[model samples]
Target: DTSRPTDLQRLIDGIIDDLIALEAPISGFFEDVDQLKRLRHSEANDYYQQVYGLEQRRQAYLSRLRTQFVTRLGIRTEQLMRENEQRRESIRRTTYGRVEDCIQWVRSRLEKLSAMEFVEDLEQLEGMFEEHKVDNHEIQDFRQNVDESIARQ
Candidate 1:
């Protein structure tokens, strides 16, 4: 008995929520329209004007929503790219950096390096490159340099 009849109940919660979220006016659709409808049909121009106003407001809100969405998407894409670059650097430090240091040490003492150790180091470095999907001009040049060093020895 406490509940109002369905016909008397308010059903504009969705519109109210949007108005609150977007800080937009109702565009005189609810409170003013009923009074407008009560007027004679001779004033049909008033009804059309109100409808047009509402349409304009809706379109403006849609434009704002789309702009905000695109801006957020762009920010997220840039963030993801930065995260990927960071991970690549971390991998390089752990994999390529360590291997490069070992290779450099071996090169510095090539005269004392055992043939087996040199071959093992070369293979390990190559494996590290392949495993990490490294593909760049610098890395390619380094690989070529390693091959040439081994050939010369």
Candidate 2:
């Protein structure tokens, strides 16, 4: 929070401390250059480890983000598909109801209606059924009845 040093501030403070320690004379005069080399090498190794750890954390974050996104997308897609299927079924039922009602209306007036009017109504009903890709056994039976009535007439 406000009391704690930010990561950047902490890094800056750490570097200042490291520089002071590195400048301090370990020996009386002109200390071994090898000791200096080793110190710098250790610092570089520590930085590399830090960078590697940050990289691993970055990769893990991305993996988790991708998984969550895919899961949400899949859930949404499945929900839409279910909605689409329900609408399709509702339309199917409605189409069948309309076709059935029309067939009944035509059959009620079949004897009184002229052959032309009966044929027109049947064609309209057939078109509705065909448009919805349906196969109604009643339609076929009605067709036979129409044919027999026309022949009798």
Candidate 3:
């Protein structure tokens, strides 16, 4: 079997992928003291420092990522705001049209009613006192009391 040179790129890719995918108690593998402790042996102390530097780079990348996320969010919010304004105007037009239609229907129906018929319909209100359980005699007494009080004033 032929021996191949060490795949440094593959090792770096695997490490970066692991750092990105880390979660929970294993989060920030490069920053974790316990994980870095393994690389801090007398022979590899310099390597540990390099790993610490990589962690700082990851933090810088995270800052840039947040900026990009905010920019995209602002653009989407502006687009949605414009869309909502258009929708509001459309709803206002629809509501006005519906109100006008209702008014026309009511006017047409009222025009069909004769004055005598309308008067008869209004005269039915005379019975509402009993329907509402209100005594007409008590109302007359109250009205007389109010008239006397107003005269005194």
Candidate 4:
């Protein structure tokens, strides 16, 4: 007696009211599901197609982000290799020039490299390398010398 057709209508109405009170994204998801149910009609099908296209674009953007990260990592490694090459060239050029002038030239090159994201602790490295504290520059010099010497051999 209490469970009539009106009871079913009240239950449906309560569900609809709860769904309507959800946040925008949840509401949109539910709306899209509703539109899917109505897709036998023409307008609902068109709207669903548009949402599908937007989903595709969102996926493409995510894919592009992944590719870009890989490309940037490759570029960073390439930059490290090129830096080693240039350092060897610098050492060779420095050997033929005055020591003070060579140091200045190296300092200038290091200055240009100051903007690189690879250099996290600039002040600490500068103190370590420029002052011969930990043989940092000497290690770099040795690496350059070895590469150049091996190339000639």
Candidate 5:
């Protein structure tokens, strides 16, 4: 195999194809992690679980590849898998930070609402929600509560 250049080239091509196939799932996992930031709070947990499942699958596949393929092929697949894991972890941290910020913003808005004049506070809260693009059932329910309180006043 070493003396025959064509046979060696064919072996390299097969290894390259296997490497590309392995990378496809990693790319998909990256996309899923990136998308977590865009999802609403209500949808985040389910999406996170799905992504976590994918990560588990990817880890299992990588472990198999490391043992069965990388060792025999003399490839750098382990390094690539490690880098992907790092990227996934970084994205997860960013997603959690964003979710925490959203929660804090909602809490602060509610606190401000409690201390302000009714009509003015309602308008301000509405504006804040609109500006932040926070359209969720919880915020809507809060707005409805405020409106009912205003009507009673």
Candidate 6:
């Protein structure tokens, strides 16, 4: 009976040792899985941060390009405005010079004409009129000619 008890105690101790051995490997497997999960989470975080950085850089580059384009457009517009003003001033000067020349030519022609010739021209103009009824069309044509000459100047 003493031998039987010793055999039973030895069998129970062996079973306990087997259970501890199995638990050691199982616990190690759980630890390995936890470590893998942490690593995967860290990798995902790093990838997201990289993508965010790239997006920020892209936005900055586009903003700079937009600013450069706007600045160039403004400069071009100012140059065009200056050229337009210069052209207008040149046209004004040319028109002024032409009007001055026309005035001088009229004064010279009036100075060259004798008083008798001027009176004779006036008499001829009166003779062409019909009994105090002047032709409105002829007057309009003369006015249009004067207007055209001034415009040409």
Itemize residue pairs with steric clashes in candidate 2.
none
Whole-model Cα lDDT per candidate?
A: 0.46, 0.43, 0.43, 0.48, 0.56, 0.46
TM-score, one value per model: 0.24, 0.25, 0.27, 0.26, 0.32, 0.29
Where does model 6 exceed 4 Å of error? 1-76, 114-153
Model 3 clash count equals: 0
| RMSD versus native structure for model 4 | 28.5
Please list the residue runs of candidate 5 whose C-alpha ends up more than 4 Å from where it truly belongs after superposition: 1-76, 119-153
Report how far off residue 11 is in candidate 6 (Å).
Answer: 99
Query: What C-alpha lDDT, on a 0 to 100 scale, does residue 54 get in candidate 2?
Result: 49
* Candidate 1: RMSD to truth: 28.4
What root-mean-square deviation over C-alphas does model 5 reach? 12.3
Better structure of 3 and 5 per TM-score:
5
Worst 10 residues of 1 by lDDT: 7-16
**Higher-TM-score candidate among 5 and 6?**
5
Off by over 4 Å in 1: 1-24, 27-30, 41-44, 72-153
- Candidate 4 lDDT score at position 70: 31
Question: Which candidate's lDDT is highest?
Answer: 5
| Residue 42, model 6: Cα distance from true site in angstroms | 96
Comparing 2 with 4 on TM-score, the higher-scoring candidate is 4
Candidate 4 lDDT for residue 84: 46
Which regions of candidate 4 fall more than 4 Å away from where they truly are?
1-33, 39-41, 74-153
Q: After aligning candidate 1 to the native by TM-score, how far in Å is the CA of 82 from where it should be? A: 27
Worst lDDT run of 10 residues, candidate 6, spans 131-140
lDDT of 5 by residue, 1-153 (tens): 234545654565566456547556755764565465445346554554575566556556646555555555555556557766775676566556545555676788888667755455787978866755654644664443344334323
